[model samples]
Target: MSSLHTLLVIASLVIGGMAGMLYQKRRNEAENIKLNKTAEDIMSRARKEADEIVKEGKLESKDLVYKGKQELDREVKEKKKELSQQEKRLIQKEEAIDNKMSSIEKKEEQVARKNQEAEDKLKSVDKVREEAENLRNNMINEIEKIATMTREEAKQLLVSELLEDAKIEAARELREIEEQTKSEADKKARSIIATAVQRCAPEYVGEISVSVVNLPNDEMKGRIIGREGRNIRTFESVTGVDIIVDDTPEAVILSSYDPYRREIAKMTLERLITDGRIHPARIEELQDKCKQELDKHVLEVGEQTLFDLGVHGVHKEITKLIGRLKYRTSYGQNVLGHSIEVARICGTMAAELGLNEKIAKRAGLLHDIGKAIDYESEGSHTEIGLEVAKKYKEDWRVLNAIASHHGEEEFKCVESVLVQSADAISASRPGARREVLESYLKRLENLEEIANSFDGVSKCYAIQAGREVRIVVEPDKVNDERLVTLSKDISKKIEEELTYPGQIRVTVIREARSVGYAK
Candidate 1:
C-alpha cells in the first residue's frame, strides 16, 4: 500500500511542475508582446518629429537664399548705374578734346595765312626800296654833272655844308643843354651860397704886428725899463719880444714877429707893472708863468673851438695848432676868425646840399692849420698842413682838402671841393684882403677887357667889384642861342688870361628891339 501511495504523489508533483512551467512561459510571452508594441509607438513618434524638423529647415534655407539673391541684385544695379555715369563723363571729355583740337587747327591756319601775307608785303616793300635807292643815286649823279664837279668833290662840298650846319645845330643844342642845366643848378647853388654867406658874419679886426699895453703912468714905464734896462732886457731875453717904452704918453708898445711871444710878453709886463716888482728875477718869473698860462689858454681855446664846432676825437697836437691860429694873421684877417667863418659857411652849405656837415666843418677848420706855423715852417701852408695831417692819421678826404684847398692838388671828394669853396668865400669877402686901389682897378679893367675881346660882345662892364662881368651882345652876330656860347668863351678867356679870387660870373644879354610909330 505505501509504495502505491508514493507513486501517485510523484505523478501529482510532476503535473504541478508542468503547469507552473506553462504559466511562466505564457507570462514571458505576453511581456515580450507588450515590449514590442511599445517600441513600435516610440519609433513612429520619432520619425514624425524628424520629418517636421526637415520641413522647417527647408523653409528657412529658401528664405535665406531669397534674401541673398535680392541683396546681390541691388549691388549689381548700383554697379551698372556707376558704370553708366563714368561712360557719360568719358564721352563729354572726348567731345571737349575734339573741339579744342579743331580750334587749335583753325588758329594755326590763320597764322600761316598771316605769315604768307607778311612775306608778300615784304617783297613789295623791298622792290619799292630798291627803286627809290636807284632814283636817289641817279639824282646825285645828275646833280654832280650839272654842277660840273666830280662826284667826290660834290660830296665833299655837301659834307662841308652839312658839317657847318651840324656845328651850328650842335652849338644850339649844347647851349640849350647848358641853359637847362644852369637854370636848374643856379637856383639851388645860389640858394646854398647865399644862405651860407648870410649865416656867417664874423668880426673883422685889423690886427697889427705890434701890441700896445697902456701903463698906469710915465713912472711905470721907467719901472718896466728898470735900472740900466735890466728888467726890460730880461723880459726880452726870456719872452723873445721887444718892449718899446716910447714917448707915446703912458703906453708901452710890445713888438714881436711871433704873436705868441708878444702876447706872453704883454701879459708878463702887465702883471709886473701891477705888482710893482719890476726886476730881472721878477720879470723872468712872471714871463715863465705867463707863458705856461698862455700855453694852457691855447689848449682851452682849442678845446672850446672844437666844442663850439661840435667836433670830436681831435688829436692834442692838432688842437694845439688850431689854438695857435688865434695869434696868427693872414693878410689882414685873423686866421682863427677866418677858419671859424669858413667852418660855419661850409657847414651851412653842406647842410643845404645834404652832405655831412661835421666833415665839411672839420675840413674847413683844419684847412689853414699850417698858417699857424707858416712863419717857422719851410714850405707852403698847404704842404706843411698836408704833412701834419698825414702824420696825425687824418681822414684821406681831410688830407686831400688840406693839400688841395689852395688848388695845388686835385680834389678827391665833394667835401674837399666844399672846403675849397668855403675857403675862397672867406678869403674873398669884402674887407677880407688888403688890396691896393691900383690893383683893384686893374683887375676890374682886365675883366672888362676879357669880355670885350670876344667877337660877339657889343659892350661889357665889370661890376660887383670884379666879381661879375655883364656883356651886351650884338643880336645879329650873337643870336639868343649863341649868347650862351659867347659868354662861356669870354669866361674861358678871362680864366686863361687873368688871376682873380673866387669865381667870376659871366652874364650875356641879347636884346632885339623893333620900334614902329602907331600914329
Candidate 2:
C-alpha cells in the first residue's frame, strides 16, 4: 500500500492536468461553431441570428420531414387505388377481346366444315356423272356386236332401231311418271314452239271471203238464153262454170270451183250486157283476152312473192305454179301463209337449239312447195314436194323436209325434223286456219267440261290444239297418288266422252318446292 499508492497518486495528477487542457480545447472548439457566412448571406441574416435560424431550421426540418412522409404515404395509397382500377379495366378488356376471338374461331371452323362438305358433294357428283357416261358408252358398244365400233355408231344404230318402239312405249308409259315431270316436259316442248310463235308473230293475220255473183234482173236472164238454148250451153262449156239467174237485186249468179274462171265469166257477161252484143264470137274473144291477163297477173304476183321470200334457184314454171297456189285454198287455209309462218317458227326454234337457223328456215319454206305441184302430180303432197324441191335445186335437207312433212319419207337432217315440227305447229295453232267453227268450239268446250266432270278436278286447260288437257286438282282434296288416279280417270272420261284429233294427254300437276333462308 505505501509504494503502489505513491506512484498511483503521481500518475493521477498528470492525467488530470491533460484532461483539463483537452476540456479547454473542446470548449474553445464549441465556441468556434459560428453561422457559416455563406448561409448568412443565403438566409439574409446576421451571424447570431443565423445560428438561431439554423436551430429553428433544424426544428422546422423535423416537422417538414414528417409532413413529407405523410404526403408520400397518401400518394402511394392513391397510386395503388388507380393501379387497381386500371388492372380491373384491363382484365375486362382482355376478357372481351378473348370472347370476340373465340367467336371468330368458331365461325371459321364451321365454315371450314361446310366447305369440306360441299367439296365432297361436288366430287361425288362429278364421279357419278363420269361413271354414268362410261356406262352409257360401254352399253352402246355392246349392242352393235362390233367391238371396234365407236360409241357414236352404236348409239346411232340403237337410236334408229328403238325409235319406233320407244315412241309406242312412251305413249303407253305416260302415266308411269309423276305428273310434275310430265308437266315439266310438256311445258319445255310447248315453250319452244310457243316462244317461237309469239316472238315471230306473222304480219298477215287476215283471210279472204269468196265472191258469188247474182243477176240484177231475172227476166233479163231468160232473154239472154238464145233460141235452142245452145248459147247458154256453149257459154257454160267455154267458161267451165255454172251461170244461174236467181232473184238477186242487180247481179247474175256465177258459180265455179276455180275463182279465175268465175271471174272471167263474170267479166264477159258484164261486157255483153253493156254492149248489147251476146254472141259466141265475142265470148271467145273475151275469154281469150281474160285468160291472158289472168295468166300474166298470176305470174307477176308469184315472181314478186318468190323474190320477197329470198327463195333462190326457183324455175320460172315452178314459180308460176307456186303463184297459182294463191288462188287455191287447202280446206279453207292459205297454204302460202302457213308456209311462211312455218319458216319463221322453224328458224327461231332452230336458233334456240344451236342448229342452222337459215337452213331450217329454208327447209320450212320449201316444205309446202310440193303441195303446189301435187295438183298435177300423182303421188302424195310430200313426194311431189320432195321432187319439186330437188328439181328446183334445193338442199338435200330441204328436200328431206319437204318429203317428210307428210311422213312420206324419213327425215335426213335435224333441220328436216324441225321443219316438220314447225309445220305441224303452224297447222295446229289457234286461228292459224279455218276449221268447222261449230266443231272446233264444241271440241274445246267438251275438253274443259269433260275434265271438270272428273272428281277432285278444279280447273282444266286444253292445250296443244286439244292434244293435251292439263287438269289442276285442289292440294287439300287430292294427294299425289290420287292425282295420278284422277288423271287416269279424266283421260278415260275424255276418251269416252270427247272426240279429238290425234292423242289426248291428261296431266295432273303436284308440286313441292322448298325455300329457306341462311342464318
Candidate 3:
C-alpha cells in the first residue's frame, strides 16, 4: 500500500511540475511580445523625427537662398544708382570746364584786338609827331633865313632880349613879393610874440650886489669882530667876503663880487652869530660846512629848475654850474632869473612855432650857463659855454643854440633861432637889464654917426630907442635904386660895427621935388 501511495504522489508531482513549466513558458512569451512592441514604437518615433528634421532643413535652406538672392539684387541696384550719380557729376564738371574755356578764349581775343588798336594808335601818333617835328624845323629855318642870321645867332639875340625883359619882370615881381611877405611876416611875428608874452608872467628879480644880514643887537657886531680883529680877518680870508659893520642899524653888510662867496660868508656869519661861538677855527669850520651845504643846495636847485622847466639829463658838474647861476648876475639882472625867464619865453614861442619845447627850454636855460664860471675862466661866456657844452656832450641843437645866441655862430636849427629870439626878448624887456647912461647915449650917437658917414645922407636920426635909424638922402646923389643900395650898406655897417640887443632897421628916404610956378 505504501508503494501505491508513493506512485500516486510521484504522478501528482509530475503534473504540478508540468503545470509550473507551462506557466513559466507562457510568461516568457508575454514578456517577449511586450519588449517587441516597445522596440517597434521606439523605432517608429525615431523615423518620424528624422523625416521632420529633413523637411525643416530643406525649408531653411530654401529661405536662406531666397534671402541671399534678394540681398545681391539690392546691392546691384545700389551700385547702379551710385554709378549713375557719378556719371551725372562728370557731365556737369565737363560743361563747366567748357564754359570757362570759352570765356577765356573770348577774353584772349579781346585782349589781342585791343593790342592791335593800341599799336595802330601808336603808329599814328608817331607819324603826327614826325610831321610836327619836321614842320617846326622848317619854321625855324625860315625864321633864321628871314632874320639874316644863323640859328644859334638868332637864338642868342632872342635870349639876350628875353633875359633883359625877364630881369625887369622878375625885379618887379620880387619887389611885390618882398612887400607882401614882409607885411605878413611882421603881422605874424607880432601876434606870436604878443601871445607868448601874454602867456608867460614871471617875477622880476631885483638887483642886489651885497647881502645885508640883520642883527638882534649892535653888540653882536663886536662879538663877530672878535679880539684884535683876528676873527674878522679870518672870516674874510676864509669866506673871501668883506664884512662891513657900520652905523646901519642892527645890520652888517657882506660885500663880494662873487655872489656865491658872499652867500657862503653870510651863511657862516649868521650861523656863528646864532650859535654864539665865534673863533678862527669855528669860523673856518662853519664856512666849510656852509660850503658843503650850499653845494648840496645847488644840486637840489638845479634838479628843481629842471623839473620846473621840464628839462632833464644834465651832467652833475653842469647842474652845479646851473645852480651857481643863482648867485651870478648879467647886466645887473640875476643870471638864474634871466635864464628861467628865457626858458619860459622860449617854451612859449616854441609851442606857437611847432618846435620841441623841452629842447628849446633846455637851450634857453643853459644859454648863459658859462656865466657861472666866466669869472674863473679866461674866455668870453660864449666861448667858455661852448667848451663846457661840448665837454658835457650836449645835443648838437643845444650847442648850436648856445653858440649862436649872441651871434657868435650861425643858427643851425629853428630851435636855435627861437632860443636867440627868446633870449633877446627876455633881455630887452623893460627893466629886464640895466644899462649905464653913458653907454646908452654912446650907442645912439654911434648909430647916427654911422648913418651920417654914408655918402648920400643929408640928415640922419636914430629913433625908437636906437632900434631904427632914418636917413634923408641927397636926391641928386641917391636915386631910388641907390637908396636901396645905401640903406643896405648902412645896415651892413651897423651890423659889423655895433654890439646891440635885438635888430636895427635902417631906412633911406630919397625925394625929388620941382620948384612950383603957381606963385
| lDDT (Cα atoms) of all candidates against the true structure | 0.88, 0.75, 0.89
User: Model 1 TM-score?
Assistant: 0.58
- Alpha carbon lDDT of residue 10, candidate 1? 97
lDDT of 3 by residue, 301-366 (tens): 988998888898889999999899998887678889889988888888888888898889989999
Q: After superposition, how far is residue 206 of candidate 2 from its true place, in Å?
A: 8.0
The numbered model that scores best in lDDT is 3
Select the stronger candidate by TM-score from 1 and 3.
3
Instruction: Give the range of the ten consecutive residues with the poorest summed lDDT in model 1.
Output: 428-437
Q: Candidate 2, residues 441-503: lDDT per residue as tens digits?
A: 779889999888766677789887776789888777788889867887888877887765445
- Model 2: what TM-score? 0.49
**Model 2 Cα shift for residue 462 (angstroms):** 6.4
Off by over 4 Å in 2: 1-192, 199-210, 214-228, 259-276, 351-354, 373-377, 436-438, 444-463, 467-519
Q: Per-prediction TM-score, please?
A: 0.58, 0.49, 0.65
Question: Cα lDDT of model 3 overall?
Answer: 0.89
Global local distance difference test of model 2: 0.75
Ranking by TM-score: 3, 1, 2
Error of 1 at 104 (Å): 19
